[model samples]
Target: MSYNLLTSIDNNRLKQLKNFKTIILNGNNFTSFPSILYQFETLHINENPLCLAPPNDFINDKYISATSNLYVQINDKYEEKLFEIYQQIFIENLTSYDIENLSTRFKLSKTDMNDFREKYSHLKRENKIEILLNIWKQKRGSLANSDALYKFAQLIGDKNLVQKMQKTYLLARKIRI
Candidate 1:
């Protein structure tokens, strides 16, 4: 059977490490190198044995090298990735005006609405109706169309407040432009 090399320390079958081309160690229980690990072409050993250093040959080897020696000094990449994750998390929380401002600020080719939907599918499902209502109200404007006012009334679910807001909107609309 083909094996996935990126096994956690808790995997009982890590004994089969000899069968894989690469191994990613993301655990702390490892006190020393497993003899089976040397068979791998690449090894990603992270956050273990802070005092221990890789030998010069291991550092120079084309097939096997330590991650510590390869420094990724990239501020721009980190910033871009951070922005992507943030957009993924917070897109639904933002208003249309907020999204437009963000698009302008970032010079994005497309709005992050899709990314948001993908990342927060479960949360979106739980709040779908309310979120859509909020978005519709935001798009339709609290003071614009009569249909929008009716929808806003449905959203508020209050007769008195809806009438008051509709009257206020009418009064405001009548004022000099």
Candidate 2:
């Protein structure tokens, strides 16, 4: 195939490779990828420095867009699906098992998984109890426990909190009736 990272190709070679189909460049020497790379059908650029940027030189006639266009589409789909997974776990009030399971399932490094968990923490048992108490205070005519919150309580296995929640719920139901 073609190589560009850590490899210096002279202008003469670059000119000869205009018809070349695939090349992987790392922008190791340059602040941005060379315009010569725009000619390829498939391109891969990895380990780019913070200063390295894509050369905004997509040619309509010669450049086929297999690299940039495909990368954007794939990145977008991956991010969307990832967001959905995070939301699902957060709403479920993620259990210790879910945390371990999701990280393993995604093959994420522990550090990466920790960062993700920090962003999407589930409500603590106390927080759920507080919310339930608030609903009782508001007397909103209905006292339906949110499924995620309840499920999370079940998974958390705090018998005291569960009993407290049960008592609170009966009290709220009595008030409503």
Candidate 3:
């Protein structure tokens, strides 16, 4: 059997809807979703400019799934890139001093470092870069001494910084001071 549902008022569907386990609404104009949608076991509402605020019923109902077009796609890409960079950095065991030395060696602006910190909270948690550097000096460690410093220098594409870091490592080793 085939069925069709139509209504002008957004609430009308909710009021009339009954005995249906699944419903698919596509290519419709909806500023906000009705709470009745939460009653359905499965609902597919795609291609609608729903308000940014998620329905309270959906949030309260743990079983219901609501996917927003705006957040899901962009967040997914951001998360993927974040993880990729994180793995590369983690494998080399990048330390705080290494990050700072590399930043200075590469001439990375404060904004760039801030952006990296915002995107990768794990680095902050690992004690590589504290949220408040001066407040927690003793917890800080040097990445400048690490062999991974070379790999980080190469990633930044700054030959000058690479050379400077190499020179610093050599000088520190020779002086043993």
TM-score, each model?
0.25, 0.29, 0.32
Encode model 3's per-residue lDDT on 1-177: one tens digit a residue: 112232223567566877888877644544456678757777765544233334666666664343454425434443343333433444334343455554454445577668656766475444543322222222223332245445655676655555655665565344321
Q: Give me the overall lDDT of model 1.
A: 0.41
Count of steric clashes across candidates, in order: 0, 0, 1
Candidate 1 residue 94 C-alpha distance from true site, Å: 2.4
Error of 2 at 16 (Å): 0.7
TM-score of 2: 0.29
lDDT (0 to 1) per candidate = 0.41, 0.46, 0.48
Superposition error at 32 for model 1 (Å): 12
Best by TM-score: 3
lDDT tens digits, residue span 31-140, model 2: 34566766677666653332223556653444446545644554444334333333333434433334455345334456655654565468664344333333332442
Q: Write the per-residue lDDT of candidate 1 for residues 126-148, one digit (tens) a residue.
A: 25433433444354453323444
- Estimate the TM-score for candidate 1: 0.25
Q: Rank the candidates by lDDT, best first.
A: 3, 2, 1
- Candidate 2 clashing pairs? none
What residue runs in model 2 are displaced by over 4 Å at the alpha carbon? 1-9, 26-29, 59-177
